[model samples]
Target: MSQKITWKDKLDFILFGWIINWAFPQYYRPKYHYTRYRKILLINVIPQKILGINRFVKWPVHFTSVIHSPEKITKGILCDPGDNPGIYIQANNGIIFGNNVGIGTGTKIISANHNKEEHSKHDTTSPIIIGNDVFIYANSVVLPGVKIGDNVVIGAGSIVTKDIPANSVAVGNPCKVIKHNPPHREKFTREEFNKNIPKQYHHYFDISSHE
Candidate 1:
């Protein structure tokens, strides 16, 4: 069971980022591009300032978060990370997002999870739960009570209407996990991926004299 975040939670998240974005930009390096600075201004810093919640972020105007709407939402969350501008969330008692969620351009997440027994669910609303390290590509829409598991990748233009397990890759209109990225495997870290090897090591990696 995830928690429903409040307006204060939004402010707290944005305000706390200043030490990283403003004072110390190195620790919390922007994973995307520099344009994120302006996005932070528009979505996180600006909205709170206008609404008179709290304005702690200033300078460089960086954003690692997007719109977090709590109005009429009963449970869960609406997390739109990455460079996307906004998220329009509607739910009665459900919605959640894991850390480092990359929602592509123009994505919509429905809060309401459906109940099959309710034949009258023409306009029903439920909750949506997303796991950690989930990447949702562009124009993806997630319906209610859909539990997107950790380390999952939702392909672009997908319409997710069911529960997705962890370490999986899902795609299509009714998204399904086609690829499963098993956990606990020894994988390359960013540092490992970018490791600069000595010329002697060329034979070890695919420097391909083989090619």
Candidate 2:
């Protein structure tokens, strides 16, 4: 059975949670998991609001992240673009992320480049399109106009300058496909999915906390 919401919880919601919820309107919707909503209120919204970090952005992103032109970025459900600490996302041109996309710590995704002729001007050509189930690991830099296909894994410290084909694992200074992998089509059960997630982050997806 799910744990009941006690009066203390209600009081907390009334006094503290609701204020944070009202301030950060994005996660207040019903579609978010109840546990996720509460965690975002406690861990993200309240602290960031108090510290004035990421005060302009309305999403549950980490305070240490730097994002430009949030309106130009497209995200999917369960997608936390620029949620990881030290992430830098510049979506001035645009950035389209598919479902279950993971941008690792210190990763930088920039969708516009400085004009060669005019250094002060930006060259906005196209959006960086990242497909479903893609994971770009730590300290990687994804440049403008790169289309990373589905089920792609980019290794740490890579500099992506071109389109990465589907089901490929790429790495290095100039990121290139090192190996080809099979398409990820196998759906996992709830238990299986939970097992893949680290124990420390378990509270974010606590199924038992559903109300």
Clashes of each: 13, 0
In the range 1-211, model 1's lDDT, one tens digit per residue, is 3346556545544555443344322122222222333455465555545544323322121243233344433221122332354434444555655444567776777765456688555345446777755678878888866888767889998999999998888999899889876542222212231123334333322323111
Each model's lDDT comes to 0.52, 0.73
Runs of candidate 2 exceeding 4 Å displacement: 1-39, 47-52, 185-211
- TM-scores of the candidates in the order shown: 0.53, 0.71
The C-alpha stretches of model 1 lying farther than 4 A from their native spots are 1-39, 42-44, 51-83, 113-126, 182-211
- Superpose all Cα atoms of candidate 2 onto the true structure and report the RMSD in Å to 1 decimal: 8.3
lDDT for position 207 in model 2: 36
Worst 10 residues of 2 by lDDT: 186-195
